[model samples]
Target: MAVYTHLGSERLAELIASYDVGELVSAKGIAEGISNSNWLIETTGRDGTGARYVLTMYERRIDVTDLPFFLGLLDHLAAEGCAVPATIHDRDGAACREVEGKAVALIEFLPGVSPSEPSPAQAHSAGRALARVHLAGTRYPHTRQNPLTAENSAGILARFSESRLAGIDPDLPATAARASDIARQMLGGLPESIIHSDLFPDNVLMLGDEVSGLIDFYFAANGAMAYDLAVTHAAWAFDPRGETIDAAVGRALVAGYESVRPLSAEERAALPLLAQAGCLRFVASRTEDWFDTPGDALVRRKDPMEFARRLEFYRDAGQGAFA
Candidate 1:
């Protein structure tokens, strides 16, 4: 959980006044991520509706200039039937407004719960929704390049070359390097579209056993659809230690994805490689976090080598690991 930026009540009231939403009744900082400051805002609007919203203060790893692209993509995907949060624009027709040099926006509060122990059916539902998201994303006008590419992965490993990964037998960096090279080549030919590049379990919300919403599109970009699936697989199929793969959940995820938009022969072949790259990419980011996150940052420091263990397992089993 994270709440990197703090806001006084007067400052929050000032911010809310800019929007059409009613007077702020209460605003509480929600500590649920490592990247930004978020608040669950409640208001009784001028329109006589009790409005609920999430106010996000863009803190780290997000560009203020790219807010339109990300928020616009959310709007576009929602129009296409993807259950994404709607961005509430200011009275001046701006979705993103500045708050103490940081970009901020109010998003429609989605009603649902993020499942802690997701079932195979939930995984399947998420996969189906993902395919629809990809399909609808074809019409989106905006695009952003994926930052977590093979080139970046190599750069990450190189930056941390001297550090030793604890509790893992064999040289892990070399394994990541090899996987990086394979992922780069194998994923090049798969279909590209607007993908929720960060479609992990936490990003999806469930109402009952069905997917009620998919949140957090900060990492959304134009990339291979299968790679998005790989990201989901790597995120959802892992145990808490990130060592064991939940084969049942993994199967449901892929099956549901393919049930909507069937994977091409090439995409199917590339799944293993994409999954490896996904694991390696997170390992790289978490490694950076382990070293760079400041003491005051209100975020969890995820273990980088947990992904290393996952990569090792995939390395031993190859494509058959997911099966």
Candidate 2:
């Protein structure tokens, strides 16, 4: 869970007033999101009207230096007619502000419900939206090395090598070793660009069957475009049974994406490995968070086996599944 400094509602109201956004009528913690302490802020107008805004107290887990890039990308995408959160600037026109020694920002509250399981058509639309974001963000000035590099994988593997009974079964260490090898082999061959590394269903908000907006830029960074597609595939195609991924779903998604920008042969070749890498990254992080974090925390760690099962499915099916 994100470590929250938890400024009380009184202080929050003061902060909002400083932005000249009227009086805070109500403020309460939002239960979703693991990376930051989010709150729904309702402000009262002088004419007895009100408006809603999302207020976020940024977490310490991510480097503050990356905030500009994340915010800048959102601004650029919003300006370019992408459906994304619009950052509310402060009185001095700053997108972020310091409050109680933590960075806080307000954004226009997007209206929609997060789909539990998107249909094939919804998945296709999401794929196209993601491609649009990638195309728009390619020339963004900020660049950072993807934290999921081979070196980082090796480091994590070394740290977790000795674990025996980390999860449902006792073979997690061996699985980690195999994943590390695959990651090392694939890391150098893939094409790189700005990617929304976590494009899961929960991060996508839908208005009816259409995707209305995308959220959660905490994991955004410069990475491979194929890796981004692999991430989305892992998220959108997999079901609870861990059986075969739906080919129709894959086709729809790819068709939607190619409608905007086509994929290269190299990217196509690397898609399987990229999908495996996405699985391993999630597995490693989930395992670490599951075992290392205290049980009393607000954040509930997901089952690492879910990702492990997805990895196994991709490995067994090979590149034919993607084709």
Give me the candidate number with maximum lDDT: 1
Q: What is the per-residue lDDT of model 1 for residues 1-52, given as tens digits with 9 covering 90 to 100?
A: 6687879999999999999899999998997655789999999876867889
Which ranges of candidate 1 are over 4 A from the true structure? 166-171, 177-180, 293-300
Report the error of model 1 at residue 251, Å.
Answer: 0.9
Question: What's the lDDT for residue 235 in model 1?
Answer: 86
lDDT of 1 at 231: 80
| Candidate 2 per-residue lDDT over residues 5-56, each given as its tens digit | 6777778888998665779999878876776888888888535577788888
User: Listing every candidate in turn, what is its Cα RMSD in Å to the true structure after a full C-alpha superposition?
Assistant: 2.3, 2.6
User: All candidates' lDDT scores?
Assistant: 0.83, 0.77
Q: Pick the candidate with the highest TM-score.
A: 1
Quote the positional error of residue 182 for candidate 1 in Å. Answer: 2.6
lDDT of 2: 0.77
